[model samples]
Target chain A: MANMIDLIEKSEVTGDFPKFQIGDTLRVFFKIKEGDKERVQVFEGVLIGERGGSNKRAITVRKISFSHGVERMFPLASPRIEKIEIAQTGYVRRAKLYYLRDLRGKKARIRERQDYKKGKDLSTAQVNAAK
Target chain B: MTMGIMATKLGMTQIFIEEGVRVPVTVLKMDPNFVVSKKTMEKDGYTALQLGFGQIRAKLVNKPTKGHFQKANVEPTRFLSEFRVDEKELANYEIGAQIGLEFFEGVLSLDIAGVSKGKGFAGVMKRHNFAGFPASHGTHETFRHGGSIGMRAQPGKVLKGKRMAGHMGDELVTMKNLRVIRIMAEENLILVRGAVPGSKGKVVEIKVSTRKPKALPGVGGATLEEASKNPMKASKAGAKGAGGKKK
Candidate 1:
C-alpha cells in the first residue's frame, strides 16, 4: 500500500539532471519570468549540501560576493531550473562542506581534484544520450 | 448525509508545482468499497448503502457474519460502514456494485472523519489549552492545575461541564473543508492540502464538503489541471508580478 504513494511521487521525478557532488562548484541556469517575458539567469556557487530525495530533492549552494557569503537553496526537480553545469570539482572528505564557512581569504578555497573531468564527462554524456 | 468512500491515510510529503513552489500534501489510498447491502425507506425506515472494505480470511469469519455475506451475494469484507442517502440517490447504487474514485469527480474540497491519535490521561493545559498557574513566585507543583471552576457565591458547587482533562484524543474527529490538491486515479491516491486527523494507515471516511467552497488558487478560478500546468498564474509568487519572488 505504501508503494502507491511512491508511484505518485515517481511520476514527478526529473531524470535529466547531471550528477554532481557536494564540494563541486556548479553553474545553475534558472529561468526568471518578468512581465510576460522569460529570461535565463546564471547562479554560480559551490554545492554545499543536497537534501531530500526523489521529487523533493533540493541543493544548497554557497557563494561569496563582495567579500560576503551568500547561500541559496533550489529544488533540483523544479522546472524553473534550465540546466546545471559542473564548473570545478573539489577533493573533500565531508558530506557537507559547512566547515568552510568559518574560513576566509586563502583558507576558504577548496582543493581542486586532479582527475575530475572523467566523471563530469560521463554524466553529461549520459544526459545527452537520455535526451 | 451523503455517500462517502473509505480510504487509508498513507502519509504526507511535499511536491513542487510547475512554478517551483512547494505544496504540502497528505496522501490517501482508496481501496475498493463493495456495496454489501442497501436499505430502503419503507423497509428499513431510512435510506442508506452498507459498504464493506478490506479483505478478510475465510476461516476467521464467524457463522452469522458469513451468512450475512451469503445473503447479500457478495464476498465477506473486514470492515463494514453505512452511508445515509436521499431516496432518489439510492437508485444510483446497487447491492453488489463497487465504488471508485470517480464518485468524487469534480469535487474541490472534502470532509474527512477518522479516529485521532490517543493521548491518555492528559491535564487541563494539554487537553483544553488552558493557561495554567504562573510558574514563578512560590508556584510549586501546582502549575498544571485548572485554576478555578466557578465563582464563590454564584452556583455554590462546581459547574456540571467544567473543562478538566482526563482522557484526550482517540475519538472521532472530522476535519472540514480540506482542499483537494490532486487525484491520481491510476495510482488510487488522493492528495489533500493539509494535515489529516489521524496517523498514517488509519481508515478515514471522505465526503464532499457541505460548506461553501472557496476559490481555487489560480487566475479566474481555473481548474486543477489548468492550474498545475500553469502554476505561475496559480501561485501567489506569480500573481504578485515582479515583487513576489519565491525563495
Candidate 2:
C-alpha cells in the first residue's frame, strides 16, 4: 500500500527540506496566489506535528500571533512550498508538541538543540508510514 | 472494431493529477483483445464482430469450442463476445487483429458493467433501502420489518416490483458515465473518477457510454456496454457507444 502511493506521487515530489524534527523552530517559505500575481510568504513557528508519507506528508507549525495561538499546516513536499529554513532546531522528547499550546509568555520557549550539525544533508528519511 | 474490451477490476486507489488534484481511480487490467470472427450482414443477416479476450488453455476448451478457435487461427480465448458494428467501420478490423489501451485514447468518459457482489437474501433495510420501523420507543419484532405492503378491502394484494427485500446484488450491474481521469498506456491501467460495479479481480466490460457524459467540458459521445445482454440494441447502441469511446 505504501509502495503503490509512492509510485503514483513520485513525480510531484520536489525540493527536500532540512531534517528538522518535531519541536524545532522552522521558517517555512510558502507561495501564495493574489489575484493573478504570486508571492512567497515566510511563516516562522514551532513544528508541532508531522504526518503522512511521500508527497502527502504534512507539517503543523504553531506560533503565537498578537497574543492568540495560530497554527498553519503545510504539505512538506508540495510544489507550493518554496523552501524550509530551520531557525532553531530544539532538543525535545515527544513526537508531537501539543502541550505547548497551553503555555504562554516565557513558559512556551523551547531549549536550543546544542548539537547543530553543519553542512546540508540531502538524504531525508521522508518515506515515513502514515500514523 | 469492438466499442469496448474486457478487463479485470483491480480495486481502487488515490492518485494525484495535474495542479495537485487528488483523484480516486479504479485500476483495471485488460488483456490484448482480438477479433475472433466477423458476422457479415449478407450471411448472418446482421453486421457484428466477435471479440475474443482473456487466456485459456487449449486442452481446457471443449472439442467444439476448440474447433471454433481453430478456424480463427488465434489462441483459444476464455471469453468470446459479439459486438455489432456498422458496415463501414467493419472494414477497419481484420480477424486476429488486436486492440490495446490506445483504442480509448482521448475518450474522457466511459461506462463499465460487471456482476455485482452478491449479498445473499437481505432484509428491507439493507436490500431495498426501505425505512423500517423505529428501533427504540418500545419497538418489538417490527423493528426491522417492512412496515405495511398495501391497504385492505379494495386492492389487498401486494403490488409487484414494490421494491421489497429479496435477492440483493450478484446481478449484472452497469455504472454509466464515469469520468476517465487518467490512462497509463504503458501500464494498461485506466484511472476513473468514481467507483465501478463488482469487487476486486472480477471481470468487467468497459466500453463507451450510451449517454453523453456531462462531467467533462468538451468530451462527448455514446457507446454500448451491454451489447450481449441486449442484442436488439447491438447495431444502434453499438454505433453510438463507439462514438462515445472513440478519441
Candidate 3:
C-alpha cells in the first residue's frame, strides 16, 4: 500500500529538478511578486546544506555580498522557484559548508570536482533522486 | 456544536503553498467513521453522536462489544467516541451513516483532543516549566525541586493543588484553534497547520473549534500573532470584522 503521507507530499512536488550536491554552485531563478507584476530574480551561490524530506526538501545557499556573507534557504518544491541551474560542481569533505562562513577571500574557494563530467558522484545523486 | 470525528495521527510534515511560503502540517488519517448510535435529549438527557472508527476483526471483540456493533448493524470498530451536539444539530445524522473528510469542508480551524505522550515521574522543572536552581551556585540535589511548598505558620499545610512533581503527560489534552490548512477527501486525509497532541498512530478527536473562529492565520489578512503584536494594526484589521463570537 502507498504511504498516505508520501502520497500527500507527492502532490505538492510538481517539478523534476536535476540532482546537485552540497558543494555545487547553484544559480536559482526565483519568482518575485511585486504589486500586480511578477519578475524572476537570479541568485547564484554555493550550496551550503540541504535539509528536510520528501516535498519539504530545502537548500541553503551561501554567497558573498559587499564582502559580507549572506545565506538564504529556499524550499526545493516551491512553485515560486523558476528553475535551479547547476553552475559548477565541487568537491568537499563535509556535508555542510558552514565552516566557510568564517573563511574569506581566497581561502573560501571550493575545489572543482575533476570527475564531475563523468558523474562520479552518481551514488549521492541516486539517493537524492529517490527522495 | 457539530459532530466530531476520530482519526489517527500520521506524524507531521511541511508543505509549500502559493508564494513559496512553508507551512508545517500534521497529517491525520480518518478511516471510515460510522455513527454507531445517537443519544437524544428525551432519552439520554443530552444530544450526542457516538462515532466508531478503525475496523477490527469480530473475533477480537468481546461479547458486549460485539453486541454493541450488532445493535448498530455496523462492522466492529477498534475505537468508539462521542461528540456532543446541539439538539437541532442531532437531526443531521442517522445511525450507521459514515462521516467523511467533506464534513470539514470550508472549516477554518479545529479543536483536536488526544492522549499526550507520557513522561513518567517528571520533576517540576520538566512538568511545569519551572526554572531550577543555578548549577553554579551552592545548590545541590534541590536543583529540580519545586522549592517552598508552604509558609512557616499560617495556613501552612501545603495548600491543596500546589505545583509539585508527579506523573506527566499521557492524559487527554485538547489543542484548540488549530488552523485547518488542507483537506484531501480522496485520500481520507486532513492536513492541519501545526502540531497535534500525541505520538504517531495515537487516536485523536477532531471537531470544529469552540473558540471564536478567527480568520485563519494567513489565509487572507494578517496572522493572529502578527495582529496581536501590533494593536494599531489589529484594531485596523478588526474594523474589517473577520471573526465574531460563536453563536
Q: What tens-digit string does per-residue lDDT give for candidate 1 at A4-65?
A: 56655665565466667778888899998888899998989989888988878889998998
Query: Order the candidates by DockQ, highest first — what do you get?
Result: 3, 1, 2
Per-candidate fnat, comma-separated: 0.42, 0.03, 0.47
Weakest 10 consecutive residues, lDDT, candidate 1 chain B? B238-247
Best by TM-score: 3
lDDT top scorer = 3
Ranked by lDDT, the better of candidates 2 and 3 is 3
Instruction: Select the stronger candidate by lDDT from 1 and 2.
Output: 1
Q: What DockQ would you assign to candidate 1?
A: 0.27
Error of 1 at A21 (Å): 1.8
Question: What is the lDDT ranking, best to worst?
Answer: 3, 1, 2
Chain A TM-score values, per prediction: 0.82, 0.82, 0.86
Candidate 3, B1-247: lDDT as tens digits: 7668999999887766554567788988888799899999999998999999996887899999888888888998999989898988888888888888778755667899999999999999999999988887688877777788899779858889889889999999999988766666555677787899999998999988766545533434334453234332322232222122110
TM-score of chain B of each: 0.85, 0.83, 0.85
- Residue-level lDDT of model 1, residues B41-99, one tens digit each, is 98999999898887889999999999888887888988899988899999988888988
lDDT, candidate 3, at B145: 76
Clashing pairs in 3: none
Cα misplacement distance, residue A49 of candidate 1 (Å): 2.3
